[model samples]
Target chain A: MTEPHDLPSAAELVEAVREFLAHDVLPAVDGRVQFHTRVAVNVLGMVGRELALGPAQAAAHGEGLAALGVSSEAELARIIRQGGADDRMDDIGRFVRATVRAKLEVANPKYLAE
Target chain B: MSDGGRDAEPAALLRSVLDAPIENLRRLSGGASRETWSFDCGGRPLILRRDPPGAPKEGMAVEARLLRAAGACGVPVPEVVAAESSFIVMERVEGETIPRKILRDDAFAAARPALAAQCGTVLAALHRIPVEDFADLPDTDQVAEWRDILDSLGQPHPAFELGLRWLGENRPPRSGTTVVHGDFRNGNLIVGPEGVRAVLDWELAHRGDPLEDLGWLCVKAWRFGVNDKPVGGFGDYDELVGAYEDAGGGHVDRDALMWWQAMGTLKWGIMCIVQGSLHVSGTVRSVELAAIGRRVCENEWDLLDLLPYGRD
Candidate 1:
């Protein structure tokens, strides 16, 4: 293997475990077990997507914050709460929408599609 | 799904109250706060709503009174059988409360065409009830209340901040104060082929602006991913407004409703934070609540769409 952790990379391993639960365990279970198994599957799926997309998303998210001239999300939030951003509503709105989109990309991209 | 020998204490509570043998007691899923159990008592299908141990009992008693008040106003609601501080027994409502099923299932297709109007009519009827009659209901200044809640949660959600600012700045003058069904939405409705069978979940009922219920109903979360249909993914906004006005509700102001809608979306986003905090604080550990934390942005997306600042 090229790195310290051998072949089935972190993302690949999460996918393998998720698939095992979804395909092997989900079908055989019913009621509470079935529901929890599905949730577990979804959790892993989200983690896998984050591993694949998080780094680039972090970069894009920084750009989004820069568009609003805020150093951190908390600062942006405080400015809006205090009405300091009212004059620049259009710019702030654009930045908010883009960042929310990226967040859903990790959380649930289906939300963005709709 | 009869869970025999489980929930033994709750079953005993039912037996003592009804003085009849309880059978086929099984817990119903999907309620976030209250325990809902279905049981047969004296040849009647009843639902028992119990607060978790040590929780306040006054809420259940107040909810029972509100159900009767709404029913008196011709709103379809479950009939309360018996209500104590910690528990309430009501006639079990039989219909689907799941949004996706109510939106997609064939049985609801016919109901879908009429639900929006029915919802409007029902809300109008509900709003007609005298506010003074509900002496126990608390007044909620929602825009301010939710902001305080998000601030206390200490999580920075910028989208929520933007929407909250917009709502506060463009606050509409109060047209009327009425009985607002705070949690009225698609999922909280019991829908059948005929239409809405009963309105469930009155825990959030309060005294607020009459338009609040309508605005809350149209919140996109209740639409279940269907963006086109604005009113619960069932009927048009015109149908809802028309029916509401026709049913003795005052003139439906579009701008006021839109403002409330934006406010509703932000309130929901903050509520998601509160729910997630329950998990984070280890007060309640469940996958459902944890999953809701990530779902906050869904409402943020909807909130931004509602505000016309930067239309995408």
Candidate 2:
């Protein structure tokens, strides 16, 4: 089984699955299987993007909070878990501004994962 | 193999509608939580929106109700024909989803002011609609809401915590409560030669500070890679605000717009992270969704820069 990270681009992952289905699964299934292969293909494409980016984002977010004087990860976790209007702006707004600035500052030489 | 294979209940329900013929079904991308399809019915094009396989059951009615309200308010939205627990049928507007095409092409730049004007008019109109009609609407408490989402994700996200704190400390006083299209952005607006033909996607629509919509429109995420330009990645900030004001929105406070713009970036970043996690956990999987997740950090960084404290 290939790890999610090793799956290359979303297009490539989707193609690999299609090839597998055409060669292995299609032959075994009866005629008129009526699969919406296009939907599946699109879904996989979306999944590929998620796999490539999820961890890096989470990590960046953790780093951003620390920079903002958040004392501990646990506190931040608790805050997020409670999820209400704090006297503060919503988490969504803060993270976006911070992340965009970070990317602008350091286009991350190792950031080939897009 | 008639069109009844995938899910029997939905297909049967759809078939029951009068004059509903299965027109061509093509998946409309960009929604992680819902699956959207454009199909023709009885010679008229229509949209079918359904929850992705395992999405939560809440909010369907809210979306439908908001769309109805916006439609009543002269916002160019698809007409809601019918709605069920997991599915909604709507009139399909003829236009293209505003993408990099509008930004990259110089000809479209001329139409930016008009598009911005329409957006302002539509949004202001949406805000004017009486909120009393929607009885079960959620309150727009910033801190509490973020806290709840973080808890649901089941882990610590430092960026979120920091953002929450900053927002609380620098909370902008609400000017007035109005209907806010919680997710107004470039991709959500359908455009044509005339201008924005329709505003779609009401799932995140809510009642809150009207500036929230304005801020969302200017968010970097909606720019779709055109960082140099701000309004839907088409024109400058002044042009957008100018057009918005001309459309009877009155003078907008620059400070408030700035605050909301920053807020827009933060909100979108969190959503991207949540979607990314869903894909990672194998709950919901999509490459585009994951790619969006990767982009959240960039948005966060942008939000940081916008804040006074973020500057060196």
Candidate 3:
């Protein structure tokens, strides 16, 4: 079964739109619209990053939870909330730090260094 | 105030209050629930703060009184020239309200170093204001309030639940009640080269433990990326506590303050979700609010950092 339509990938298309907003649309606007355009561009960049990194990041998170003996993130969270992780905060800390870093990779990578 | 038709113009109603003609009555920035207008009367700039038209005016009424009470207690606030049930007419204080500018601007270099201490002193004064007259203000448990708010969102925020549980287990012994400026932080404080010029947005004012205000100031979310300085990204926690004590504030319990910081981070994260829900639920579609929703992860990261863990 040969599938037909192939040109710019979804990520590539998003990148193109992001560049257009940043280079062309951004400098052309001012005040509220300009501000919102910047946000829009940021949102696009986030979408692109998510498209690129989301699957692996999700898998890594699941593995991290599994390593903590929790089957899912929700279970890990519930167990932690219930103080079941109180004795093993070291593990929880490492897991949370790694998890948050992965999220920052998509949300705003600049903040990771900060 | 005249009990005129609901459709009556605000300008006309204000004209009766001000003897001189009003000019340049334009709407300033406000949220969906509130209205802020700037106008000039008798060659003086004035601000009109009111609830959105047709909404109940009770909160504005309390805020007007709070401003006056705060001023009386030596806390810097906009002077309320005239107040009615519907709106408050205050002398517009000119200053920078943006936190980033106050934190990073070389123009505010002189004021930056002193801000944390200044905040302590001002907050002490605000807390000393007698709360007996604010009977209408509701007293609610801060932790329970946030838990309810988060639960109401119907979102499974495991980090929030974890944070909430931590707070519940480590609940601090209640400090003495005081008039608290609930939203006391960088953005709410109008900063100038001299120092904090005035406090703005008293809508969140209430009676609570004075330390709640101190803890809220240290919330990593409010630090605006300058997390190195725990006190609004400008000064240290000990420095904030020292200044507060010097200004007649009660004792500082470091553990309690840290607990509140963790709680405040979760509180802010939950607030971001709520703001995003307004966009998600089609109540108020806003890109800005939706973007804030993405920042909740930042709070989660901060929570893990702040919580007592293996580092201890």
If chain B of candidate 2 is superposed on the true chain B, what is its TM-score? 0.85
**Candidate 2 DockQ, CA atoms:** 0.17
Best by TM-score: 3
What is candidate 3's CAPRI-style docking category based on DockQ?
medium
lDDT for model 2: 0.67
Clashing residue pairs in candidate 3 are none
Model 3 Cα lDDT, one tens digit per residue, B274-310: 9889888988888887887787788887887776553
Which order, best to worst by DockQ? 1, 3, 2
Candidate No. with top DockQ? 1
DockQ of 1: 0.70
Each prediction's RMSD to truth: 3.8, 8.7, 2.4
Model 1 chain A scores worst on lDDT over the 10 consecutive residues at A1-10
In candidate 1, position B185 carries an lDDT of: 92
Clashes of 2: 66
Sequence-dependent TM-score of model 1 = 0.92
Point out the worst 10-residue segment of candidate 2 chain A by lDDT. Answer: A105-114
